[model samples]
Target: MDSTATGMRTHEIFIDGVRQVFHVAGTGPVCVAHSGGPGIAWEYLRVPSLEQRLTMVYLEPVGTGNSGRLDDPRDYRLDAYARFLHGVVEHLGAEKVFLLGHSHGGFVAQRYALDHPDRVAGLILFATSPVTGEEFWNSAMAEVARFPERHPGRPEAAGMPDAFQEALAAGTDEDYTTALRRILPLYFADYWAHEELAPMRAGLLAWIDPMRGEEPAPFDVRDALASIAIPTLAITGAHDFICGPRWSRMLHEGIPGSRLIVLPGSGHMCHLEEPEAFTLAVADFTRASVPGAR
Candidate 1:
């Protein structure tokens, strides 16, 4: 567990009486990681490989994990999330930091970077997109539809149409994770191959009391991408049903000089499918992007 790791303290701040918490772990250059799910625990994105090289700061997004919940669903908007994160970063006393956002976290990351590009030294967007509307979801569903063509005999994907929605409506966190497990086979190119370690890792994740918040607001930041001048890297799994290569290309192309990497034979969980590669890619980008970080 590396309890001895430097700066392993968990810090907290109050936002409208709800405590927003962040855990600092490992050592060396600091890279703040925002997990996906918008409602997930930050521990879900823990990359031990990146932790080996960089001090990973895991931010518990508002209304999730140890963070406080909001009574208004509108408070779940990107701007509000960005403001909360900015407050956390300021509390850390860091002049600049590398930012990593995964899936839903990517939404908040883009928002934070747009609102405070100067505070960001580099950006890592993984398994994410610039927008989440009818088109984005349709594209993902289409990918799931083609799963049988690539993975013959995996008929469970047929029910994926209702998988996410059921999970959302399931309410309880345990029910949500259980529902997600059903669609997880669609998230990895070789699910059984990594199932042993992956499930163990999931068990290690930390969750807070039931998350109380409104449905996440739709995101649209394609035009705003032009203003993000920091070094940016967008990586996605080729088979990522949710945030696939199309959006990865959008970020790579929209952000000037931004680089994109597509992992073959993988799905939404590319970091777990190929952790070593994921780790190195991030290490390489942060080194080149952040001054003196190399």
Candidate 2:
């Protein structure tokens, strides 16, 4: 598999009446993974090194990005999503594929791995959590609090959680875009000083529009974690406001044979903040778990 810029192929696949857009890069054992939100497209997560090491299959779930939208919101549940992913892997004729997920995507991946452990070769969970509890939400908001002091809209944004939720519930593209623009910076405050995150920032806003008014369903994968026997890598950024190190620690403790890696001075988007370190960690973990690799 070659992860070089010129060797990738992008295409769309239809399953159960939904079209999923994906990019295939390199040529080796397959690694089929999705992005977070249950609505976010995979475009924002492009790991070139992983693509080079394995035939990376980045899938945009149904109703996201270039994929076809579904009329029923019931189809958005984690169980349905995991079944859809299984069909995708089987459709691709991959008997043993690696699974890597980021943020909310990791939640999806966790469920899928537990449901079909025999089909999975390995698991990579980057800045993901099994569940979003009150403590986690409060901690995330506290992280957001740090920036209000220097941020331009500090006064207006302070204690504006109701306003933010109202904007999201407005169910208009413009409303979603406005709220995302105002809130996204808090997720990456630690890395804003040195890195250019314009692409991720823009993509996130675009991805949030269709998801407006769609409540995030509760996901409890604690029991599933114990059932996951495959080697797993759990990576988190120390400063992650979205899903913090505590989430990663919980995953590491619950999932058997899982290792945890926390990158210093990084946030939710650790891959972007510390690409070199992130890539190296993934490459080492993947190689170690690949079938027949010593």
Candidate 3:
């Protein structure tokens, strides 16, 4: 962390009586990053390469990390997260800041940008979709079924089926974390080939807030995507089984003037799997999209 800029610091603010925690590092134009999971820890989404060129604020979204949780887990929804994100951006003192969201985080980002377009300088929707229904679930399931064929001879491949089921049924923090570790390989284009990601898998942390019998409202933003007027970039990995090109293309086509980038050799975790390319795409987009950004 460079001392000349925001450097490295953890800041906490109270949003509607709930504690909101965020980590700031690197320098240059501010780009607030929201991690996915609606439950996974925020650390997994940190992009060191992009951080070098932009002041990165990694948000520990409500119900995750040191941030305060909602009394009713059912209150955890995209609109709610987007509101909390707005509070964080306001607290950062930036009238407008570039926003980057990954996976579930991308959903929140879309909602936020749509709800508060004036406060956003630019939007980066990475590895996310515009809708979630039978079509989305079916596509992912079909890909999950092919995991074994993709990683032939790997013993862990056999456990993916069970891992996917466990992840869905996980009700406790420990179980959720364990399930995430088991299914994490599926998020990468070639996890076995890259041993560097092992530490991340081992250190993975998550919290599960079950809806308690109630299902979340089906996520569908296709009809409303055209309303987003901010500069947008929809990037994803070609190999990302979940939220791959098929979904990113929809985001690109829906958001008028939005750019798209598909990392050819990566998967869901494009930032980590293809750091150099990922950093370049995001950093360049930030500079081009945000006026007066360093």
Candidate of highest lDDT: 3
Model 3, 1-294: lDDT tens per residue? Answer: 133453568888999999999999888888999998768899889887887888999999888889998987778777778889999998989889999999888988988888889989899999999888789989998999898899898999988977898898887888889889989999989899889999999999988755521236678889999988899999999999889999999999999999999999999999889999999999889888766756
Model 3 poorest 10 in a row by lDDT: 209-218
lDDT of 1 by residue, 1-294 (tens): 234555467888886576888888777778888887757667667787787888888888887766777776556766777788888888778888888999888888898998899898889999999887888878776876676677666566557656856755776667766766666677777676674656644554333224332235557889888888889999999878888899999999999999999989678878888888888888998888766755
TM-score of each: 0.88, 0.85, 0.95
Reference-based lDDT, residue 9, model 3: 85
Residue 36 lDDT in model 2? 74
The model with the greater TM-score, 2 or 3, is 3
User: What is the lDDT ranking, best to worst?
Assistant: 3, 1, 2
The residue ranges of model 1 lying beyond 4 angstroms of the native Cα positions read 1-7, 154-159, 198-217
lDDT against true structure, model 3:
0.88
- Between prediction 2 and prediction 3, the one with superior lDDT is 3
Runs of candidate 2 with Cα error greater than 4 angstroms are: 1-6, 149-167, 203-217
lDDT of each: 0.78, 0.73, 0.88
Q: Which pairs clash (backbone N, Cα, C closer than 3 Å) in model 2? A: 1-27, 3-52
